[model samples]
Target: MEHEPLPSESHAEVRIVAATPEVARRVAAVLRRCFASTEQRSYPAGREGGTRLHLTLDTARAAEPARSWLATSESTDQDRTHADEV
Candidate 1:
């Protein structure tokens, strides 16, 4: 079946693959707290019996703290990389 195209906006599709459903759900829960998202869809994945979860997030609606945290984290990572090269 052909699914409808996602709306054209600041959004992201996230896929999480983990050894167990609990782990995938835990990660999804954290994302839900940070952004507005659709209900997650789950599927079986890999020969090792892992779980795959897919959800679409409206990044334009990201929580204030999450946006600041991501910006800070990116700068911190870049600083660490430059330090390592020095």
Candidate 2:
């Protein structure tokens, strides 16, 4: 598959610090869904016992979808938690 380069103006970066590899992987999965097209790198031994993940996304394509997906996820999570309490 061929990937088109994102314009410099459409690029955004994210940095995440996770305490364990499992946590880092989970964070990366969320980012992957948010930005269908992304480039990622890792900086281990970053701060104390955490690993830092650097992810770059094309904002023009990723921003709106990401926001909508996150909002939907948040609502679903809240609903699920509410159901569990009932």
Candidate with best lDDT: 1
TM-score list, all predictions: 0.70, 0.55
CA RMSD for every model? Answer: 7.8, 12.0
The 10-residue segment of model 1 with minimum total lDDT is: 77-86
Q: Taking the candidates one at a time, how many backbone clashes does each contain?
A: 0, 0
lDDT of 1 by residue, 7-56 (tens): 66788888898999999999999999999999999999889999999999
Instruction: Score candidate 2 by TM-score against the native.
Output: 0.55
* lDDT, candidate 1, at 62: 86
Q: Which stretches of candidate 2 lie over 4 Å from their true place?
A: 1-7, 45-47, 63-86
Model 2 over residues 29-81: C-alpha lDDT tens digits?
A: 87676665566677784557788787776655655567776456544344553
Q: Model 1 off-target regions past 4 Å?
A: 1-7, 70-86
lDDT of each: 0.85, 0.67
- 79 Cα displacement, candidate 1 (Å): 16
